[model samples]
Target: MKSNFRHIGLAKLCGWFGISRQAYYQYNWETISSTLEEEMVLMQVRDIRSRHRRMGTRKLYEILHPFLLENQIKIGRDGLFDLLSANHLLVRRRKRRIQTTNSYHRLRKYPNLIREMIPTAINQIWVSDITYWKLGEIHLYISFITDVYSHKIVGYHVG
Candidate 1:
């Protein structure tokens, strides 16, 4: 590629590509500058993470504002996100789901009998569910049986 460019000349090649030689050089310089900026940002991010391991991008960007201004670096929130994502430096969110049932218990497992059942009339099928309501510091368990066809609560118990 270097030999081809030397034989054909860069200005003619740039003209063939519908761009001026200066524009081509400018593009190359922009790439180099962007790479240097990203490297600097990564170093700052690592330094911050060393102090706060679970720091997220938004907080990091906020903390990095002064450093960025001092270093004359310009990067937006989404640009920082992209840089962290590409380099695998982004922090992952923990799953918030609370496990309410243990399916792997040693007790005998019962098959779901209502899998294919569709209620054609009222009282033909009833479905039951248990849920909890938070009352101040206590969780009150509420169990209810509902008529499938009418979509009404037939019976309920709070404990």
Candidate 2:
């Protein structure tokens, strides 16, 4: 096909494909335009990432909104994601573990007294637990007690 096209003129090839020469050139130009647009987006991503190394794609899109408008580049969130993924420029998230329970402690551990017991009515067996809740910049501790039989929260404390 390459050799045959080399011998054949582009106008003739366009005619064979049932398209005009102008349409053929327009399609080629569109490919080039898209390539250039993607390159520009990649450049902007790299520039933003240089300052904020761990910035995610959503934030990058927000930052690039103004630039895209100025350059008349049309790209959506998914498009930006695909571009960043293809270029291997996406930010890797850090795994920050918040250790609330220390199971390795040598302190006395309480045995489950109700392991063999089943609740027949409400308030017969109550379970208590604590959980951590992060609201914006604040850390909250939620302590709650529930009834086993009714599956209802009997008591709760948020601090």
Candidate 3:
């Protein structure tokens, strides 16, 4: 009968079989392949991603293919994607919410006073307006004074 531990490092074999390395190495003297080409490829991929995290699979494939081909390594785009997914190296895109006017508030509307009036000199007329902002748990109001002649802001205050 062939001994289960005849030709492999016990620790590595245990790691492959999901067993305790200490327990297996204590009783066995077997070793797996010393060539870790696959592991090396994975590490390289991770390193590239760490440098250019925003890159997608196509970009990553383009960057890695030359190196891999030079080393005579055979891997396809899909294969690389699968490897990245398995290793949790795939980049995720976050979707941002689009903000638009709701036009649902029940408030009084005002008419535009400068619709027909055009400023011809500095300080000919001053326009003022107020707006509100929510800061933390408090609401604050901001007021601004502007010179319509020069179209410059004259004063502003926030509370």
Candidate 4:
């Protein structure tokens, strides 16, 4: 079929395909360029992920932006996302459980006093919370007490 079509002119071939000759050439160029760009982006992504395994798509796009500019490649955030997704290169967010407040601790749990209480002034009620922070390979727990009225961090201790 391709051999038979070779006898016809390019204009007629494009016309039969419901496209202009210029469109056919343009589409061909775009496909080739996109494939090349995808390859380049994937290579860079793999290299970066080697060191930073948990990097998200937004950060990857930022890193790729300047690299793309240097390599004369053009791709948007969504395009990069789709490319990464299609290639199975997109990182999955891990649901890490950091036990800040142990529910099963032997100590008796305190009642929620703040549920019914409203603060009218600063330091009237200090709400305390424990949150985990990741610094390099170490996991640190931050215990903070915030003033309910002012919504300011009154005191914080990191362990």
Candidate 3: 10-residue stretch with minimal lDDT? 26-35
TM-scores, all models, native as reference: 0.62, 0.81, 0.43, 0.57
Cα lDDT over the full model 2: 0.92
Find the 10 residues in a row with the least total lDDT in model 2.
1-10
Candidate 3 structure quality by residue, lDDT tens digits, 1-159:
777766877677778988897767644542332135456678888798788878888888898888888877677899888877877888897786555456578897788878899888898889997877766799788899999888799999998
Backbone clashes, each candidate: 0, 0, 4, 0
TM-score of candidate 4 relative to the true fold: 0.57
lDDT of candidate model 4 versus the reference? 0.88
User: TM-score of model 1 relative to the true fold?
Assistant: 0.62
Q: Write one digit per residue (lDDT tens) for candidate 4, span 1-159.
A: 356444778998889889999999999999998888888889999999999999999999998788999998878999888988999988888898764555887887888978988888898899888888788999898899999899999999999
Candidate 1, lDDT over the whole model:
0.93
Better of 2 and 4 by lDDT: 2
TM-score sort, best first: 2, 1, 4, 3
Reference-based lDDT, residue 31, model 4: 93
Kindly list the per-residue Cα lDDT of model 2 for residues 35-133, writing each as its tens digit.
999999999898888899999999999999999999999999999999999999988889987877878888999999999998888989999999988
Give the better candidate number (1 or 2) by TM-score: 2
Highest TM-score: which candidate? 2
Model 3 TM-score, 2 decimals = 0.43
Model 3 regions lying over 4 Å from their true place: 1-35, 107-159
